[model samples]
Target: MVKYNCYKPKTEIICSGSSEDVVGQYYQDVGRSDSQGDVDITIGEALQATALTSGEKPVEWSDAAAIHEAEVRATGRKTIMPDGITAAAQSAATRNARTTRDEDKTKLGEVLSNASTKLASDKGATRGDAESVMSVEKRDDPNFTTHPAGVATSIAAAVRLNRRQRPG
Candidate 1:
């Protein structure tokens, strides 16, 4: 997140009399004594300088924090850092993560494509053959069913089954 000084035209009632009234307006620069318009905006908005367009993705806070840490390590001068530096780092981190995820997805797609091609080649393969191929893949890749969410889901199911089997 970022803090921005939001300023609007300051208005004043110059005169308040029975016969006539006068008004004045002027724009106040940021950090002026009478300008007290501060707003908090998300990092994405600060970096983009506008609302997200269609199909545009926003930066995640975790990515920003990671980028900030990396910049601090690289520069060795952490204090009084400019917002531009933070914004640029955050943008870079987001792009890097996106690129990495896309690459991983492509790899997974290729694996799936190869698996399907193999299955299609076996024109008379039975359902058991498909199961055998899946078991082999799972055995080869330890991470195949070890995702955090998958582990948690299996744990929850086990707990539920244990409770159902408990003695009354």
Candidate 2:
């Protein structure tokens, strides 16, 4: 809400706009006033009655108090976001997503590493037998990289190794 002097009859108009085009003198000044007559609407309903037929800053009226109340109502907003960031400082969604992705990748790596170690060190197979089976399975079978497939391949290779070492 503001008071400004207008040109036609030296009357007053109340609105938000530039300080320059104000007809004569105002009780106070805010933004510069140009001949645009276009007032930036802070809200919709407050000025419905005051809207002018035409002119620079047509959204004006003689009543400054009504404009003041309207400004308060129109500009009011709730503070939903956390305080540390201003509107200009807002960031993208990717950083949080990247962090979660990295964590999942680490957990997956640990799971696969544990599975491989367990298969290689299992009771019946020698390390060489386990390594050979794992290598061959990885090369020949599409499912070879899976934990269950590694154990199965290692078991089969150990059985073959055991059979070869026995007396014919």
Candidate 3:
């Protein structure tokens, strides 16, 4: 059988807001310059609000410490009740764990292996294809038909090539 719990608000509460958020807004509204007065007013307001909401009076001065002690005693939590478990729940959890355990690791290994095989095949195909591709026809290195000597020959060859390529 499955059990479901209903949610209910807490009876006891502590206003754990930052002193700045509480006191700052309070002082700004009260226009208080002194920090002590600001703190006093803020606490008083908090106590009043808590009292009104809980339908109880603030702790008396003499019993304040004892009240706080009692609060502290009642406050702490324990791992008292263990979480619910069922056979179906356990099986679902186990299945999820099994799927997640080596999932990414296995996927990563498969991806890397596939990538390595593809790269090897690509490299072999590229090398073989490159071997068949005709080499660039090596232009006769600066034939220097005119004045076949030094700088003059190279310049003449270059000018001839340019003139041939360019429209007249």
Candidate 4:
């Protein structure tokens, strides 16, 4: 077996053991003590035996990199969400709500801008063109206002709910 201790504040150990100690347990677990000592394990045999104990398929050499990465990640005692991550999540949620509200304002602005554009496009375009593009007309007409405003207002309300309106 080989063991290494690598850390400053606390030691971390990694080790590998002989195939006999590893593989014999596999046969005994399966009620096949007869097969125990009879098996002469190569590295391949030992790995297959370990897999049997785990109820897993045999491991491939290709899995080595992923296994190493998992081990490295597990060895560290760091919190999954550090303070920076928590702060970032809070900021992201805040930014998302702000962006959503800005999008609604931009939509509102577009409606007004488009009305101005169509009204000025040609003086003879008629009231219908101005009426179609204008927010006041849309808001005034109960049918036109219902769907979009309901959705936008609900989203705005949800943003308001998510925000820390009372300064803490």
Candidate 5:
């Protein structure tokens, strides 16, 4: 039999007896004792030698940390979003992501057009050829743009990003 102390700032709980007993109680303490919804808790088991003073015996089980850790383990990372947020909200946020993506591709095309015009004047290819190449590239890669000016203002950031990644 062993004793365990579970500590979260302002909440201290103790459980003694078997290792299973101590660990079970520790989970209970961190889960049910949290009053504020925003606190980040790290659950750890402490040996009796390094334990804090004895605390209340935990009777009920709290699955909060277990559930959260299960999700982190399954997903391999944490989300920026807070808990209790809906699946619908997550889906809603991406509603216009495709629209913005397409618009940015268009802007990237415009930048290609301008550079191509320069190539026609200073390099070997004509402006018409540059334009054709831009169209074909966009067909092959969805990220590229075919008519940048048409959507440049709407997705300036994407245009700038796509412009940097344009094929030579």
Candidate 6:
């Protein structure tokens, strides 16, 4: 049996008794590396990871509005506002949220790319080498996004929340 350590940090050791097992694990790790480098995680995964890492879920614009409404109601104020004003407020909030989410996604993508490059450096490859490999891999993968803004918005949003929650 061949035993090897996976490159992922904090991961358990892998043991393979056959060549096929080793190859399968290698491909799986590669796929995971690609996902991490692209900051591609599902909403559920993002939420879980964020909660684990930062102790809280990121609040979206809708959540903020809901909280505000609840607080206003708690003060014994009428919850009913003018329909046009409410609509306008909701529209603006949505637009601002979208803008912030898009920006955060971009930042997270950059962070992931940098992290991949750093990993390559740790393995004796230069930044340029890592970038070249990423370029080829992205080109080969039709579904890969260069910026990946929408693809990893949840993860990015979580990162933003963590930052905001951190004490100065």
TM-score of candidate 3 to 2 decimals: 0.14
- Candidate 6 lDDT for residue 90: 46
Q: List the candidate 4 regions with Cα displacement exceeding 4 Å.
A: 1-54, 77-168
Q: How do the residues 1-168 of candidate 2 rate in per-residue lDDT, one tens digit apiece? A: 566443222134575655755444343323212244423211221122122211112111111222222222222222312321111012211232244443332221121222212211112333443354345435433443523322323344444555455446
* Number of the top-ranking candidate, with lDDT as the measure: 6
Local lDDT at 7 for model 2: 26
Candidate lDDT scores, in order, read 0.29, 0.29, 0.23, 0.26, 0.26, 0.33
lDDT score of model 1? 0.29
Each candidate structure's TM-score, on Cα atoms with residue i matched to residue i, is 0.20, 0.18, 0.14, 0.15, 0.15, 0.20
Return the lDDT, model 6, position 60. 35
Q: For each candidate, C-alpha RMSD in Å?
A: 23.9, 35.7, 38.6, 29.9, 25.7, 19.5
Q: Residues 59-140, candidate 6, lDDT per residue (tens digit)?
A: 3333224322321222223343333222333454455556745443222222122222222112212233324333433443
Residue-wise lDDT of candidate 1 within 65-149, one digit each (tens)? Answer: 4223322322233542443344543454446557746433212112112221221011122233223333433443336532222
Give the Å shift of residue 69 in candidate 1.
Answer: 0.4
Query: Which should have the higher TM-score, number 4 or number 6?
Result: 6
- Worst lDDT run of 10 residues, candidate 5, spans 42-51
Better candidate number, 1 or 3, judged by lDDT: 1
- What's the CA error at residue 85 for candidate 5, in Å? 6.6
Return the lDDT, model 2, position 11.
Answer: 35
Q: What's model 4's TM-score?
A: 0.15
lDDT of 4: 0.26
The residue ranges of model 2 lying beyond 4 angstroms of the native Cα positions read: 1-103, 106-122, 125-149
Per-structure clash totals for the candidates: 0, 10, 0, 0, 5, 0
